[model samples]
Target chain A: MSSFAPPVQRLITELGRLPGIGGRTAQRLAFHLLRASEEDALALAEAIKEVKARIGLCEVCFNLSDGPRCRICSDERRDAGLVCVVEEPSDIIPIERTHEFHGRYHVLGGALSPIDGIDPEDLRIAELYTRVTPPADAPQDEHPTPIREVVLATNPTTTGEATALHIAAHLREQAPQVTVTRLASGLPVGADLEYADELTLGRALSGRRALS
Target chain B: MSSFAPPVQRLITELGRLPGIGGRTAQRLAFHLLRASEEDALALAEAIKEVKARIGLCEVCFNLSDGPRCRICSDERRDAGLVCVVEEPSDIIPIERTHEFHGRYHVLGGALSPIDGIDPEDLRIAELYTRVTPPADAPQDEHPTPIREVVLATNPTTTGEATALHIAAHLREQAPQVTVTRLASGLPVGADLEYADELTLGRALSGRRALS
Candidate 1:
């Protein structure tokens, strides 16, 4: 026999399709929505609709935005000469939380994975090249500063490393003046170095700098 | 500065209110929704709206339903004379899944919790009594069978046990003819006897029935 009403079953099915949510979690969420006031449930619906309707990729950095440019790209105080490249818009959150990078960002949408059939053409690599290149139409005063450094802040995974190296090579050939750097890796803060993997330990040893 | 746009932040805030969902998970869900196709996202939204708009409590059993009577209550084949009382509508699912219960259900909405100020008046106990009692107005052919048994299937938690005891006591005083029973408690099937808790093992020893 059918368990729940059609609407409830449909809601559960839709909710279950999310990345981490499962059948039980979807049911819990659906029930929560049922228990919530109309204003609250409708607000979530409206937010979903509004995000899709209004938000789009920034023209400059391809980060999520409500207009042509994302907030960071539009801000004049941010260093225009520095750019941080990441895999997805979500990655920008942790970097921003660090308060270390004062530059803008480039969202690749995803990292290169040959086994998964993803390649440089699948991402916004051409746009990155264009952004790094000096705009021919704009007057010198309009575009005063050229990007001097591009930080490859992609994940530490194999695909991320490959994508960064590939991008760095292209940038070196096309824009030789720009400097490329990757985030430092070491035993995580509060972690016991005894449990650190061999690859990470090897990288830590080689990249070690003079103690302050 | 705001990490996300207004709509994005609002969606994250709303999603974060769900049980077990943290701020990061909420942001992840919001981003997934943003990336989902319009049809997929709108379908979820519409389902949420439809469940709230159409569904209400079952008049007879207090289970969630689209009309006055729930599906089980409306079905003529179900054993209405045998009622299984439970704490919430969701509790009915596992019982149904077992395929052992062909009887109808009565949802209590919640168990008795004196600390939380829950009492008999707060639940549908009166309605259950009304169901058990022979209706004065119904014709002989229309309402032939009076409720014969009430299975106290509330959760085995403290409040659930108290609610079941309270209901059993009231039923004995008011409708002594009706049989009252509680679900058997013991070591779960496939569980190691050595690992079974003392209380459960003790109950199993005391309530052991003769092997066929």
Candidate 2:
């Protein structure tokens, strides 16, 4: 049997499952939690429980929410006609941090990865299509807003690019009026974005040759 | 108001409070938990609760335990006469992994730091003395095991060295029969044991001069 008690071992194991956290890091984190005040430790537990119990996906945008719709989708100030599509809910944060996008967002849950068995159908592609093209027999009291622009703000990775292309092709056939665009590919403001290959960088550089 | 819902934001804040987790990492972890299966997420929560509820400290060694005494102290095989002193309970794991020491441990909670207001009284120094020299009135049926060797296994930091020296001096005056030995100062098996400073390297070099 392991030297550590069952409960302590379990905590360590659970912590190690997190991204970037190794076994040693997990042990350190567990010990830190143990040394912390009961109130502080329990607060973290309560926070995890509360988030799981209360927060869910926004019905319209698939962003994290406490109710049927996320705060972004419910806000009257955000432009409904200009939708920025992203791969994951976490992707939206950096965009928001930039304060460059005033439009609404469509979270795809994840990008298309054929190797990982993720496809167009696996994403929120159908939902996005519906948003761009509403039914003709919609309620008279609530007029549906026609999406003018669908910025494919997915990650610059191969999967992200493939997802954007797949959705763009579908939108063109499904709704001809909507304009689709991808985030500019170039050296990031700071460093790398997703794990976009070096060849993609060459293309990005070629595209940006005249700008500099 | 923040863009994220209250519960989501609260979880991110709580996650950020952990030792190496920054705001971005916390947000990622919080979202990963949100995306994880309810079973997986709740298991982590349950583990945290269980550890706090069940685990306490080893009465003799101060290591983490489920009952009055830790497993090491209760074990019949481990020698009580030879105790390895460490700064924290977490430090015991590495020594155990090495399989070099079969003795019991005494966790001092932390190394002495006068600048941080930590003194001899702040640590379990007096308790170490008591363990080394038991009461004469102890029953013959319950014979106290006299500690022969005290290994100063504290980290090789400035504070750790100072703490070791302080304990060694006290042991010299109080229990001259007991031998107090600090861990050998040398190059680590692998580089980078939490940024070993220049002075520690210098000490290691001086100690290794004859052999090299």
Candidate 3:
């Protein structure tokens, strides 16, 4: 049998699973939880549960949302025609923080990683194709809502690079009317979007170079 | 109004309350939680609540416990007479991992942080004193348990050092018969026990030096 009680062991195990926490750090966190006031401890617990219960993926953009559409997608002021495509929901934050993009976004869920068996089908590529292309039937209304441009904002990593290329090429064939562009090379050659500083990312947005 | 949806904002606000997590990290974690599988998200949530529900302070030694006494204090094999005094429950893990000590522990809650107004009374110092000194009256049916040496294994920080000094001095007056020794100087002078590597902590445990 182990020296620590079951609750202590459980706390340590759960804490160790977090991104940066190690065995020692987990133990410290476990002890901190042990010492915390009942209300405070339960507050953290309720927060986790509440987040899980209420928060969900945005149907339009695949970012976090409480309802079907995220705040960005639901906003009438947002430019729907100019959709910026990226790999993950977390990527949306750095872009949002920069205040550079007035357009809405489309999260691909993940980049195309053939080595990982994540091909074009694994992402929301089909949805992106539909979002840009003119509707199958002509609109009964006075004017059809046409998508004008799509910025391929996937990360600069190997997978992110390949995904952008695949999306751009596919969009050219599927939706020739829409202008397709890729983010510029201001991103450090091989860094993930998660790690890039805001200034570099903002510059990349402003100085975005075309893939075509 | 802020751009983020209410659920996203709520999660970010709650995450920011953690010890080291800032606004950006909180936002990232919140989004990560949103993307996480319902099972994974609920697992972390239940773990937090379950820990608080099941865990409590060890009355005997002040380490975390599910019941009246912690696993260490309740274990029959552990030498209760040879108690290891530590600044916090986290300190107990390194000592256990070393496998050098086979004794129970008395968690001091925290070291004396005068700037923060944390004194000896703020910790379980009086309780530690009581444990070291047995009651005068002996039970007729049972042989009285003998409480012997106390290992003052507080951290090596300025606050930790001061706490150790205060404990040693108090123990001298309260329980003159008991031997109170501090862990060896192999520990770097100004560091907390949490940062010390296992090998160094192990060496320090074995080479424990007696206080003057």
RMSD (Cα, Å) for all candidates, in order, is: 1.7, 3.5, 6.1
Off by over 4 Å in 3: A138-144, A187-212, B1-3, B137-143, B187-212
Q: Give per-residue CA lDDT, model 1, range B1-212, as digits (tens).
A: 36587878888998898878998899999889888888887787778778878888888888888888888988888998899999888888889989899889899989999899998999989888888875688667645568899999999889999999999999999999999999998889998998999988998898899989
After superposing candidate 1 on the true structure, give the runs of residues whose Cα lies further than 4 Å from its correct spot: A138-142, B138-144
State residue B154's C-alpha deviation in candidate 2, in Å: 1.7
Candidate 3 or 2, higher TM-score: 2
* Docking quality class, candidate 1: medium
lDDT accuracy of residue B173 in candidate 2: 90
Model 2 compared with the native: what TM-score?
0.91
Cα misplacement distance, residue A211 of candidate 2 (Å): 7.9
In the range A1-212, model 3's lDDT, one tens digit per residue, is 37677866877787677666688767776667767787777777677788778877788678777788888987878888799998987788788888888888999999998889998888998888867774667464412356788999999878988999998898888888889988776677788999999877887888886899
What are the per-residue Cα lDDT tens digits for candidate 2 across B103-192?
999989898999999998898877777777777786654435779999999888889999999999989998999999989987677878
Can you tell me which runs of candidate 2 are displaced by over 4 Å? Answer: A141-143, A190-212, B139-143, B190-212
